[model samples]
Target: MLAQRAQLPDGRWHFQHGPMDIVIGAHGSPASVDAAHAAAWQRFTGILDELVQELVALRRPVQGDCPVLGPIARRMWQACQPFQRSFITPMAAVAGAVAQELVACYERSGVTRAWINNGGDIALHLEPSQSVRIGLYADIARLGLDEIRDGILTDGQFDVSSVLPVRGVATSGWRGRSFSLGIADSVTVLARTASEADAAATVIANAVDLDDERILRRPACELKDDTDLGYLLVTVDVPPLEPDRVQQALRAGLKRAQTLRAAGLIWSAALVCQNQIVTTGDPATKKLENRRAHQQLGSVFA
Candidate 1:
């Protein structure tokens, strides 16, 4: 299918091609914004074809030498390389890598900031002295048309300035667009790049699990014919869990997030399960032990 684009009433742009759907917003001079939008569209048009050509290699597990050739495909491979010790593929970072590529178009002069949201994964561009405030939605199952029509009641929010190393945000869960092996309601991550955040989110989300007879699972191949997970089991139904059980699952994910943060793969993360939330503690990657004194972050479960 051919790529298509439309301008929303709020002045943002919506672009779609095959499975890729993106919404972009920017703040800049009229001429600069127009130019950036045009450039992004041009770049977006051929992305699907480029990925299709290297689809086989992209679906393989990330190990040994990189197998993809395209720029975006290579970015995806590199992003997931850090997590190669586990079962992960370049597909885990595809959405974020594509958004990051399009965001580059708005990095020129006169454009103070720009954001590209590929589904729920996001990539940001900020000039010197610029910053952006991001809202948090911890649960995807709770999202509905009323929430969209009346503006989302954010669970929390945090501000990212130019000085901070964060420029990307991503979320993962059993209820999200991608298949998840854990029972977390959501796991949102912040990192230096969109692709890194996406990969880390996937890794952390898979760690938020606990054995219970009520949790139903099925093989990934049974649900999606081309899934990279092959015959691995993925969460399908997570029955209402006890409060203590939710905390147990969230703690598992939190440990994974902490490890990624210590390795510099992720800046911070917020994980949710059954209305309970756990974060990586500090957004600046400092004072990770003092979680209660988190001044730079707000409650993500609100």
Candidate 2:
């Protein structure tokens, strides 16, 4: 049975179906928000079943003429198609695609602003003269004691103003729910859509690797029976590294991020490892650092 939908005390709509979980928020006329929520819930019910029907194809690496039937599945496939020459599967963009789909449901309702966060892969809609503040965390482990105590990191916030081209945000790392082959503590990316950001984050995080013996890895399938990565090695643990080696790893990831940015695949990216942070893309995104100065910050969605 699918999980029941619930409205949390914080006023967010939560939906869970098998491994797919989503949180939705919107700001608009009360009637519009209500209509949007109803629309999202109506669309959310059959999504999991649709993907499950195509799970086998979705788990495979993208190749010429790959078959995918469902709307969300097709979105996932299309989002990862640009990186088909690399080692990526449609599953890499699943979360973002799900988020984007829900956002689409809300967009037609005429909400001033709405966001659908599918397990940290977020799709957003903003009208003119509107903006939203999103929190960002470099390294989850480096969060201060207070933040740890509160079970959140409130420091890093980014203003997603309407003037910006960004509409999606995604984060990936060794510590996240997904399997990562790199040693990055976290890598967050912003793009035109949630699926695009999701795919880019996966690629950039995978590039943040090194040949160091201190990093432990195991086959992805060993950790999760259904992982799309098959026998590919995934990071399990990362031991202490020299500052120079850390720089080397970050630089490698940064180069890949810059290349993606130049390709117009992403608006910006922030790669973090061992507490050090490197950013690529628009200079304004670097302002995410300034928000860290406030003490009353909360945890990042990822």
Candidate 3:
């Protein structure tokens, strides 16, 4: 029932278990697909505990390498290595790195239609005739702007009518399960892979912020035990954005999404703020029906 897609693994090398909020898959013999999934989980299981155990070490200022024991940890170090020239922790890029590694595993195994998803971030390997549908979360899921005046944005979960062709979806916002530095209610992104989409979502969500007191804010750590955003308060609440201010915030995120798309890092971005929905992909605003109607149709690409 959770809005996710993951295989139930049985074999073992290590790292695969639980409803890991994310999953990777490929189209092949049930056996082949199962083996591939087993391998991925074997690699992922216990990584969270290991990472948490080493969280302090992860936070310390490392001049060079922190060569940890966990394979995922090593990957995390390498991902952040590029930014080490500055001061980014290996954890900053951990989500993407782990996803990339798993995707690489499935690819090496010769699986055509394969994917590795982490929570919402993911990596994918699709075959011909295969496509994915991703949903966008309104940043101001609570912000009743014109949607309230116009009676568009309702106070309820988004409903997807009928199933769609999409196999991947991710949502990032200040109000979601994870953390966001900006003020967007939700920013959903879809791409060929989850890692790219995940990274891009991070980039875009950061764009949907009100630079002024236009919105309340705090440090990332204040809200969570350990957040990639060290000193920045995850956006708390928006007092009340003027019509123009809302447009400006949405515009900034759209502009940033364009840059990400141009870089070939993102296929499309769906930025939702309160009631204003801005998209740059197949699932455009017009294509989306009202929430209740959508759920009836089953708007999932899984």
Estimate every model's Cα lDDT from 0 to 1: 0.85, 0.83, 0.56
| Deviation (Å) of 281 in candidate 2 | 4.9
lDDT for position 1 in model 1: 72
lDDT of 1 by residue, 64-170 (tens): 99988899999999999999999999999999999999999999988989999898888999998988877666656666899778876666676778898999988
lDDT preference between candidates 2 and 3, better one: 2
Q: Candidate 1, overall lDDT?
A: 0.85
TM-score for candidate 2, residues paired by index: 0.92
Model 3 Cα lDDT, one tens digit per residue, 140-173: 3443566545744332233222233233345567
* Candidate 3 wrong stretches, greater than 4 Å: 1-20, 24-26, 49-92, 108-112, 137-170, 191-193, 212-214, 281-299
Query: Lowest lDDT 10-mer window, candidate 3?
Result: 292-301
What TM value does model 3 have?
0.66
